[model samples]
Target: MLTLAISLLVAGAVSGILAGLFGIGGGAILVPVLVQALAIMEIDESIRMHLAIATSLGIVVPTSIRSFLAHRKHGAVDMALLKSWAFVLPLGAIFASAVAAVISGASLKWIFTGIATVVGIKMLLNRPGWIVASDLPAQPARSAYGLLIGFFSTLMGVGGGIMNNTFMMLHNQPIKRAVATSSGVGVLISIPAVIGLIVAGWQRPELPPLSLGYVNMMAVALIMPISILAAPVGARIAHAAPKRALEISFGIFLLVVAAQFGWTLLN
Candidate 1:
């Protein structure tokens, strides 16, 4: 119990910093860490990925809220974009999370591995001046993007920020605006995703004690407070830091994590 508690606290602190630093809602970091921690705790292999993803979403709820409020105070968030994407995003999250609940754990791990690799590569190569359009996509295209963002992010145990930031950047939005708005998108994605995960895993067997479906109540208790408190500090640093260096560092970290997971899968 002591070891688990310590692990959760450490994971929460790292996640909070990453959330604030990259506007990623911390799930990209947390999910991988949680998967390993849960395995050490002797959690059932069949449900470990689902539990990790669900618990990560639960943690995101508070962390994203804190990050969003902090970014809003800085006047960096794009409220218009957030409002436009809000409704459809949750729907997509719900749909995808439902699908996630039924899939095999190994398959989910592979999915996460693929996404982490792609995101890491994108972050590593991304340039501030890169742009695909002078404006956000219109109508169906915008809606499709929102749906895809929510769907895939939920599946990978993320809060939609990585994809959201990239999408907004492609539309020529400022990085600060993209990051800030992505925080809001994380909140929207996480709330519904958590609910869906709980519902989908409610009757499953072999879940760890104190689990509500795949969401581990104990983990949430241990992680959320620290993550929420630390997130604002990260947001402040993000606004003050040299972004390119941070991006490269974070990208390398993600790639290393992905490689580790890939190696584990192979052996």
Candidate 2:
């Protein structure tokens, strides 16, 4: 128990920093780490991925809020974009979480692994000159894009930042604004994703102790406060760090995490 608490704290700290730094909602880091930690703690394999994803989303709620507030204070966030995405994003996230509940844990793991790899590679190869358009897509196209972001993000246990950042950058939005807006998307998706996970996994017999559906309450309790406190610090760092360096570093980290999950799946 003592070791578990310590591990959760360490993971939370890293996740919090990454949440603010990358606007990834920390799930990109938290999910795989939690899966390993929970497995070591003898959590049931059948529900480990689900529990990790749900609890990761729970942590994202507070972390993303802090990151968003920090970015908003800097006037980096785009309220218009947030407003446009608000409804559809959560709707998609909820639907994805519901779909995830019926899928096997191994399948979810593979999904996360695949998406993370793709996103990581994109980030690594991305150049500042890259542009698909000078502005975001309009109306139905925007809505479709937003839905895809929400669905895939929730499915992979991310906060939607990876996709949102890439999309915005492709549309010629500044990286800082993209990061800030992605933070808001994280908060929007997390709320519904968490609730959806709870509802989807309600009354499941295979869940670990102290779990509320797929979410492990103990993990949330141990990790949430630490992550929340650390997020602002990361947000500050994001502003200070060189944009390209940060993107490359984060991309490498994602690839490493994907490799870890892939290895686990193979074994």
Q: Which model scores highest in lDDT?
A: 1
lDDT values of the candidates?
0.90, 0.88
Clashing pairs in 1: none
For residues 9-93, write the lDDT of model 1, one tens digit per residue. Answer: 9889988877776687899888988998899989889899999999999999889999998898999998887888888999999
lDDT of 2: 0.88
Which pairs of residues clash in candidate 2, taking residues 3 or more apart in a chain or in different chains? Answer: none
Candidate 1's error at 252, in angstroms? Answer: 1.1
lDDT of 1 at 217: 92
Model 1: per-residue Cα lDDT at residue 229: 88
For 1-267, candidate 2 gives per-residue lDDT tens digits of 778678789989988987788776888888987888888888789888888889999888889999999888989998999899889999999999989889999999999999999989998999989999999999989989999999988888878988898999999999888988999999999989999999988989888788898888888998999999999888898888866787788789889988988998999
Task: Show where candidate 2 strays beyond 4 Å.
Answer: 1-3
Each candidate's number of clashing pairs is 0, 0
